[model samples]
Target: MDFDYDLFVIGGGSGGVRAARIAAAEGKAKVALAEESRMGGTCVIRGCVPKKLMVFASEYPGLVDEAAAYGWEASAGAFDWPRFRGHLATELDRLEQVYRRNLERAGVTIFDQRATLADPHTVRLADGTARTAKHILIAAGGRPVRPSMPNAHLGMVSDDIFAMPSLPKSILIVGGGYIACEFACILNGLGVEVTQYYRGAQILRGFDDEARGLIAEMMRAQGIDLHLGTNLVEMAPAEGHPERQPTEFDAAMGMPASDSDAAGHAAPAAPRGAPSGPIWVKATNGSERVFDAVLFATGRAPNTPGLGLEDLGVRLGRNGQVVVDAYSQSSVPSIFAVGDVTDRINLTPVAIREGHAFADTIFGGRKTAVDHDLVPSAVFTQPELGTIGLTEEQAREAHRIEVYCTSFRPMRTAFIDRPERVLFKLIVEADTRRVLGCHIVAPGAGELIQMIGVAVKMGATKEDLDRTVAVHPTISEELVTMRTPVRTA
Candidate 1:
């Protein structure tokens, strides 16, 4: 069949770019990609890249303290948000250009506009042009969702963080997921008075219970006013004159005078005559406080709406994620979807692999399928968490398991009298002795677990780990040296 292009990709995210490039360069298929925003999608422009930079910035205060404790003269000063933000913006711009250059070099046509599926093999762009393709790929990715409530638009989501003009003096972070907790830590480190309200009993739901518990405890210890079993009852912008003076804590910390009349207040309150800006939140625990900002890190949903897939008889899941077969093929043979838009292991690397596999299978005749199992992931908290494979809870339910776990203050923290602790855990099947999972909670756990993930993916047994020689004075050595079973089930 004659078509405008051999392949048309509906997004410019990691998945879409990879698929478009591979199909054009390696498979020699004519490819066209459309992106409404910056060339690099979530991971590059907003999600992982910017967030990790914030993580590094947040770590400096602690690193300075640790340095002082180690007999080196070190200290951290106030963070200059404007300066750092400018640099970050430049880096993102450079990265976006790199994505553009890569696509151009691969001989893929770029459409800097939104494209939606007009039919199984047809795409309509925002410019009122329709094009037909032999194959269509949807990698439109997901977006953060704010709560459904009155004035919810007044709050910020993860996407808004990069664009905020200035850091808030105080912020109320809502939710318990990694996004919420991570921002709580980041803002707190950056000198914002942070208060987090989570409806759940603990943060980082779906992770190891013990590891997440320790994280919650550590967050509290680090001065995040974390409130669990609590949620927002109602919220409104702070309006009218101050009924009471700003507390001594506020005054000492340089917050605007709470008692000052609307005309004379120095702190930026919600505009005096308007019902916008400073927020008054009433939480479920019978507490009402006004914060400079409220950040909703509640959740994200698939970016499948308005793509015209539903009208074309393409199946979608409950979350509006495109339902696809193992080969990333939609119900219609010529259509496919991958990455967060598919809601399967929504990591950037995973998306890249899925896109590559799709290109190989359909264009290169390589017949590849992405291995979704045993993919390693890291959460960039103050003490990062690196995990791969099943949790202890999941392992126990599937088969008899032996758990090896240890938690202790690392040597560096011990020297500084810091209360920080690291945890190492291994979940093994009792019958076969194969390591079912490895989870680490420590400063560099993310890097360590990447190495451990390779072994676990190769089906390495606990005995294999034990046989590896331990490196002296290293926290990761604990992974190999733990011989006794902490628990058996």
Candidate 2:
């Protein structure tokens, strides 16, 4: 509600918006923020929010099956693509309005324009309008990346899947990252034939090996095809018949165009809540399968391209993320950075923490720094994986940590007729007895890991956990009751 702002945020993402408002409220600095797209950054607008929606959408199919097991007759469900997509859009529209209202209520000027850093002190808007501020913040976030290929233009990335031109009946997904796995889980659970290709020996390369193996096993049982240590060689349409040939990585899967040979094969139908067209996929493995659609969950990169940071001499990481100091300060002291742009700890809550910490240290006169260690997070894949502090391997090397690992079927599986089991592992330092690592694979892993994360953060010992009164008949109770070490230091 004023003239030139004291702080002009270049991107109105989670970090930027929070920073601007906090700085103004307490810094007494008039603040204004600009957003090129919908606010809430990646997590709210494109990344986590929409991805979780797809997860819930996918889970309904499993729920239907379970309902029948509970003596309720349930048939194969039907999916109305446009209706589901429309509902998601409607909710997001409401969310966007809420974000705008929150910013306005906080007394921060919200500008709907793309922003570019003119210098450390000045920013230029998309429409050539200019704003000056004593302090400038860059939190532009990231963009989805694609590999160079013949049919990349026709394929989809994580950001594109939510608003697909059509749902894929069968999909060949490339890459082994969480993005790829999450999408595969969503599509496969929704009844789409899914084939995942990873260049590495295992998917979720950074997670515990057992969890990865079990996930692969479970997905295979559920009918999701897995191809590890693979890459795409070529992509070409099937000639006169559909079988297997060479084609783009995105289009691999299905009966190739000519494999079906001028006949459309009645267009393979998908189960309920699934897309219709078979996704074509080409993997690095020199195998080609034709599908009606292709999705590449390659990964994400900082969305700093349009916002000119290089010209300002603001140092960037090898991945193009803005490099910041311990205090989240960029090369320019008056200008700071936070969130995904920093690329240190790319999580929603981490961004919020960094934003608040920066405001506290700078305006409130308190010292703060983000600790990359002890940053607990979860990946919401099928049989979710959650971890905090060091992994077993990391702890073993860092502190001579002895890993105490266990695998067992859950009580629910014993009674509910589900075959999936749970795995829990703990890493405790031999010298200090302090628990350093935790890995879990099962329902509520995300929720359960948070408590262990607090324990590790507070320097809890193995004995402390063992002595704590554990609630009985719970999977987490197992975490506190392991007697023998799976491996010693």
Best by lDDT: 1
TM-score of each: 0.93, 0.89
lDDT tens digits by residue: candidate 1, 113-229: 999988888999999999999999999999988787655655678887776666777889999998998899899989889999999988999999889998998999999999999
lDDT of each: 0.88, 0.75
What residue runs in model 1 are displaced by over 4 Å at the alpha carbon?
Answer: 241-276
Model 1 residue pairs with clashes: none
